[model samples]
Target: MNLESPKVTLDKSTEETFNFLSDVKNFESLMPENISKFEVLEEDKFLFALKGMPEIILKKKEAIPNNKIVLGAAGGKLDFSLVADITEVATDKSEVQLTFNGEFNAMMAMMIKGPISKFIETLATNMKTTV
Candidate 1:
């Protein structure tokens, strides 16, 4: 497992941002089509169909409106969750902060860190575009 955190501020209202973030299908739409496929499961969890990626699946374990969400994946043979928070910054802006924390075996740590970081960065960028 690897711990990774990435975040961004969006120039949109909290309600608008929360609405967009609350829907898992929106993430599928925002992701680059060439890189992966996304499938939404019940209760806001999802399975990420990634190509040329080591992890076969990614899951969103928890999501709360306008506050936080947690996603997990078995990367490099270790299970890890990346938690993220969305908070109101002002009347027309919101901030997102991602923090990673999980148990990682020694072997899995190095391999998962960079890619997960990149994924979080991409998520922030894509979310901004959507907002």
Candidate 2:
């Protein structure tokens, strides 16, 4: 299944925004307040957990400077990828949108659609203040 989050404008330039997301450590600030656990394992990988959810390990899969960053699950019951697309809108202003792609059975997908939807939305919203 696939889900796309609403585009959010950031005050920084695309390059700046991209740089911020390039480091795994920076993601800690972008996570929701409800995040139960978080740790940066390396420059390109991190582990995070939300309340009532199993811990997930994610690693950077692909990156296009000042354009995109794709993170894939490194270890989890589910296989998924999250892509961040960045676009320059004005001088020092940029837009970022997130897309989540997951491979899951119909039952699992149905069960997670709502929670995952909220999770990505929260991430996108956090970008506004945390970036």
Candidate 3:
């Protein structure tokens, strides 16, 4: 399954946003308010648990300076990647987009599509203001 989140315009520069996102711990601020647990396991990895889902580990797999950050599941039940694409709009402004690509069977996709999409959308929107 593939999911694209709405793009958000941030008041910070692309480099600023990229620097903030490069730290996996910063993602805790983007998670839903109901998140049950969050832990930073390493410089590039973190574990979080949503209300209903099992704990998930995410690791920063790749990063392109001032451009994009790619995070993937790390030793978890889910198989997915979350990508953040950043583009400079001005010296002090940038646009950021979040996307989710997951490996799931049809039944699983059908079951989680709505909630997962909403989650990604919320994350993207919140990221704008957070930055």
lDDT of each: 0.69, 0.93, 0.92
Give the range of the ten consecutive residues with the poorest summed lDDT in model 2: 24-33
Candidate 2 — what's its lDDT? 0.93
- In what order do the candidates fall by lDDT, top score first? 2, 3, 1
Per-residue alpha-carbon lDDT of candidate 1 for residues 1-131, written as tens digits (9 for 90 to 100): 44444567889876778777676677776564556666666556666655787434556677777788777774446566767688899989998876767676666667767776776677777777777
Query: Backbone clash tally for model 2?
Result: 0
Q: Cα deviation of 107 in candidate 2 (Å)?
A: 0.4
Give each model a TM-score.
Answer: 0.77, 0.97, 0.96
Model 3, stretches more than 4 Å misplaced?
Answer: none
Clashes of each: 0, 0, 0
Residues 1-131, model 3: lDDT tens digits: 99999999999999999999999899999998879999999999999988988888999999999999999999956789999999999999999999999989999999989988988898898887787
TM-score of candidate 1 versus the correct structure, residues matched by position = 0.77
Predicted structure with the largest lDDT when compared to the true one: 2
